[model samples]
Target: MDVTYPSSLALALFSITLVLALFVRSLRSKKTKGQLPPGPKGWPIIGNLFQMVMNRPTHEWFHRVMADMQTEIACFRFARVHVVVVTSSEIAREVLREKDEALANRAEAYSIDLISHGYHGISFSAYGEGWKLSKKVMVTKLMSPTTLNNTLVSRTMEADNIVTYIFNLCQSGSMKKPINVRDATLTYSHAVMMRMMFGQRHFDEPAEDGGLGPKEKEHMDAIYRALDCLFGFSVADYLPFLRGWNIEGEEEEVRGAVDIINKCNDPMIRERMHLWREKGGKEKEEDWLDIVITLKDDQGMPLLTFEEIRAFCKDVNVATIDNTMNNVEWTIAEMLNHPDILKKALDELDTIVGKDRLVQESDLCKLNYIKACSRETFRLHPPNAFLPPHGAREDTTLAGYFIPKGSQILVSRPGLGRNRKMWSEPDAYKPERHLDDYSRDSMGVSMLEPDMRFVIFSTGRRGCPGTKIGATMIIMLLARLLQGFDWSLPPGASQVELVANNSNLFMAKPLLASAKPRLAPGLYPKIQV
Candidate 1:
């Protein structure tokens, strides 16, 4: 029953329909098996694999499947793997929180292994000492409050640059400029993380430096290349033993990208190790690179190899930068586009900081409204609408239902955050709900204080370690920007929707936006907050 519509989208849909038809025929022919959780039927050999891979927003498709099947939880099997999509908060907690030890492991694909430099990173690595040591080093050293405070000058300078850059762009009369918030946010995140981790940066180069050194360019380029290949569809991943069929030139592309990334980190890792060796057995620098380079086990032996060190450098480059940058940019976009929310943020900042200083981590606590705003933005535009697959490592019954080992379990933030049953007025943008001003009780705002049901940064042990740093940057950047300039969406582009362009279940990339800044100079440069 394929309809001959004369459109590319329709033609593509026909391919989907043909795939569905083949799936249905196979399902009917093989009705002897026990009931599998509900899902869209697909072709015989591939099952629904093609359709699932083709659809960019797989979360939405999962929701549709759930609705059509009227099931709270459904399992979609791909090859020998079973991917269980949990729709309700109770079940999500059951898997991600209660019996978390078994389910906290990541589902590692072969391609991920290839791109992650043999899965050395914490994000996709198997649950082991490597993950433990890497996470510990990052959480304790690189992202601690002390490091954040010590590096306040650098963060403030970047915040200052953001303000000055916006001011200059406005001064150029480019009010209706296509200011790609993605790129802008990426720049800020890259600089902040790079400076904090390596004491080096690649932004706003001086004349003598000639606009960023070669190392900085190589660093950014390699990181981007690694990311590009990390998400690439390698045939080896699908059929690792058979090596299905590598796309033309894909091997070269993957190797080149991986080499670029490995080369970028080797020098830094080597330099940090050398610096440590010269300290004469005394305590070395407590920076991230220093910590990883010197981390020794109980026997006082270096836990990670030189290769793992480079891999970890790439890991920090991705996990810390990608979401934090997008989150900051999206927060700005949401605030500027929605006047009521912008007014609320401005009023809160003015009352506390009062145009006297820029917002800082110190102000993060006292500014309840600002915190609520950050939480609400995370709720609505969760940098990653879904966390990476947390594998079911053991055959266990979750929520009193049996889940087999090797099943790929998915926890969807979109379904949970937007669920009407869970949130009152789930569609509105209100931060007051999270504030304890029970005095403002009649505003119909749903408070987000101490709740994991929304699962923006996820829950339990495997949750994102950089949540505080990431969210704090968004609050500070947004507060600082609002301090300097009033923003409005550009003419004709004012109403653009804040839609998700997710790179995968684990990454939330925002849509491009155009806007105008209308603020006076010297207003946002104050950064004592």
Candidate 2:
């Protein structure tokens, strides 16, 4: 005779077994560890999982809980894992700098795993030889000073194109049309990254209005979709058994976004791989794809697998666009609201780069006030709520609290910037605060703040490798816009409203501003496809 259990009975049995296992583990943890960080006591088995799931935007919830508790560090458990959130720079330094080696690993999550193609890329890959190899390639080949210098033409071309695009917008209507700061900035960023990655601006024909083309629009939409889902609070991430159940529909969304991204990227990658391996093409590297595809191991074999190349390409696309675009948009909006700041930035541009020419990458070194404006935006309006959580590889002690192995260390981006302890009137947009008493020639401004005052590009073993490129892109984008046109609040709008999106830190509304060409007509380069 065969004995079978009903579905409900099986679920009930599984739940009971899970709770008992957790109870046993908790008792063992209590015996071994000193004490966890301060936080609200969660239910026995679930351990704040419900609260996390119910929270619409989990970062706000975490911030509120920590605020109410009056603590900079807080721990909340989800199932068997401990999630520690850090708001203090001292503790942030402790996690990212002092104990960097132990906390270099990234947390394992369903969404990131899917987007990264099973940890093939550096950003989401587990800490090990594979991650080391990927980073080495990224730093040495793709983002090296040599490569950046070589690719200067591509970046410069896109910068000129944006000026031309905006000039056309200014000239198109009965009066000058209001510029969509967000769209123009996004296009400029997208075009630059595409030129560096694929050696082309548009996947298909270029947009008639110097905006995103049909294929490019679809591709960017998918990329933003993927980003929206990435690192989101998906219930299935903590409860592995519920993964395929499609609870909250996150899995399906990620899969669909990844599919769209792969569809756009994989074909180009495969075609290039064939050219290198089969046809012996590309004697000189022209783009980042060539650098990645042609890299070889000591044995003279391709260093990265096909999946690794694809994953790296996808990682570059996602990482480069959003933060740079958002920061520029926010900076412009803030400047429009505070005309004094706007005038100061324009004056600096006029002094450094006269109206006869556009701002170049070389000018970035001396543009201290402009760089400070960008830094201020980074501090006040970070694109994300938290840096990707760094997972602890072994049990460790941090700030006198017992941290278990595999505990996720989440550093709050907004928290560090807005901490009253760190800044005077932290909530206000004060670019002057970042300005220092250093000469222009001797003092070069950078997006990185090594003291952990606020993270533009994170620092440490697993930190971002693209800081130079990121800073150049950000400053150049801002400089060109400021030098090329006179920006003002659109007619009938008294001031730019600085409200943030409920779900994310993006401006609640895309900034609309009026622009008039401030430079000679010949200064704006003719649009080139």
Candidate 3:
């Protein structure tokens, strides 16, 4: 039988034993040779766990503590684990770049382990040969420039579809009605990923208004739920013995979301695998699924196992959807609040792409101001408060501080973007700040920030491999929306509310804005199929 919660007597006994064990270990442990970063003092056994618990959103709490200490880097201990939080680009580089080899591993967590199929996926896997092989396959076979270029037609089609959808929404009522920017952006991002992955947009019938169908909505909802649980801080992660107890209900939520995701994805993957193995592989590769399925090793056998393929599919789905959607949503909201910025972006698009045609991926190079707006959004409002924590593979010194083996190094997203030392008036949103001394040919605006000023796509050993495609998707989405239509706030609202959600960095409320077609009637492409 499974016990959801322990009996009072049993719980009391366990707590006593845990405290005593920790006390004894603290007394017996030897002092380290070097200094650790400064942080708040804690109780005997629990360390800073209670302080963290009292703080509702842990990321905010961490930032406040670091600010109070007036330190760029700080450390906190949660049941013997040393978590080093970095708010400085210098320290971030020191950990992720200078000592990359020594800190290449990923910290083990319960939700990540469950979702990744015991670390079978690339993103959260431990640093080892398995990770290397998976990254090589992902980079070379799926996300390389050559492959992405080959798949351009699919992305182009979705770009056209977004314009068509928005045009339809604008025309629905005699007068313009407020459209849900969040819904439209999510649908577009989802459609692009689906077309590239499965060669089709919908599992069943398509929604008439270019929104998600029932099946698509269910699948996307599950994906977001899984992301929330994966990034959330779990008590069981700190206390390994309480993993299955479901004390916080995180385990159950993760299991349910994973079940939904598998139900939607596994059948399709299995059917395709059967088509390749039982029947014969397709004569022509149609989509990414075919490309991954047809990959062969030196001995003329399947390169990856079924589990690995499924895990990869899931990873791509999770990674592709969130950042692009959130960035576009945030950018649009910001522009509406600052109409001057919106006008500047519109002027740039009109000057480069012209009003006679829709913005194409090829036009992205010349649109420096548009690219700056995107960069500004990334710097001000990242999707997550922190990048996924990088774990240390061995004991090392970082910025003259001793980092014990198994320590987790967290890079703050807002901390770097708003670091007073790196950016002047860091809290303000100014796209021109990125345009200073910017050259379209030499620098050529893209989502990557190699200098570690602000992270769009990270760098180093465990950096994102899909930067080329990712940059294309972001720029295209924003460009099309700006080029094809005119956007404004709803009737009564004076300005867009830029408050971020407590759990994550997404807008607390979905953005509702009025849109009117800004181009010739013939410009918007009709939806095919």
**Which prediction has the highest TM-score against the true structure?**
3
Please give the RMSD of candidate 1 to the true structure: 6.3
Ten contiguous residues minimizing lDDT sum, candidate 3: 1-10
Name the TM-score of candidate 3: 0.95
lDDT of 1 by residue, 322-349 (tens): 5565556667777766778878877877
Query: By descending TM-score, how would the candidates be arranged?
Result: 3, 2, 1
Q: What does candidate 2's lDDT look like per residue over 1-529, in tens digits?
A: 0112234533553475487676576464434377889987887666887677565578899999999999999999987778999999999999889998999899877778888888888899999999998999899899888999999999999999999999988888744568999999989999999999999998878888887898887788788778877757765667677666765666777788888888888888999999998899776999999999888889999888998998899889888898889999999999998999999998888888887777889888888999999999999999888888899998897898998888899999988999989988998998988877345566566677988988898889989999889988999999999998889988899999998875568887889999988999988878878
| Tens-place lDDT digits, model 3, residues 1-529 | 0113334433553474477576567475546668998988876666776676666578899999999999989998876678889988988888778998898998787888878888886888999998998899889888877778878999999999999988987887753579899998998899999988888898778887777889888889888888887667665677677677766567887788888888877887898989998899778878888888888889999987888888888888898998899999999999999999999999998888889988889899888898899999999999988888899998998788998888889999999999999999998889998887467568566567877888898788988888888888999999999999899998898999999987789998999998989999888888853
Error of 3 at 337 (Å): 0.9
What does candidate 1 score on TM? 0.80
Instruction: Provide the overall lDDT of each model, using Cα atoms, as 2-decimal numbers.
Output: 0.63, 0.85, 0.84
Error of 3 at 11 (Å): 10
Better of 2 and 3 by TM-score: 3
After best superposition, candidate 1 residue 136: deviation in angstroms?
Answer: 2.8
List residue ranges in candidate 1 displaced over 4 A: 1-36, 41-46, 53-57, 172-179, 203-238, 242-244, 247-257, 278-286, 436-450, 492-494, 502-529
Superposed on all Cα atoms, the candidates' RMSDs to the truth, in angstroms, are 6.3, 5.1, 3.3
* Number of the candidate with higher TM-score, 1 or 2: 2
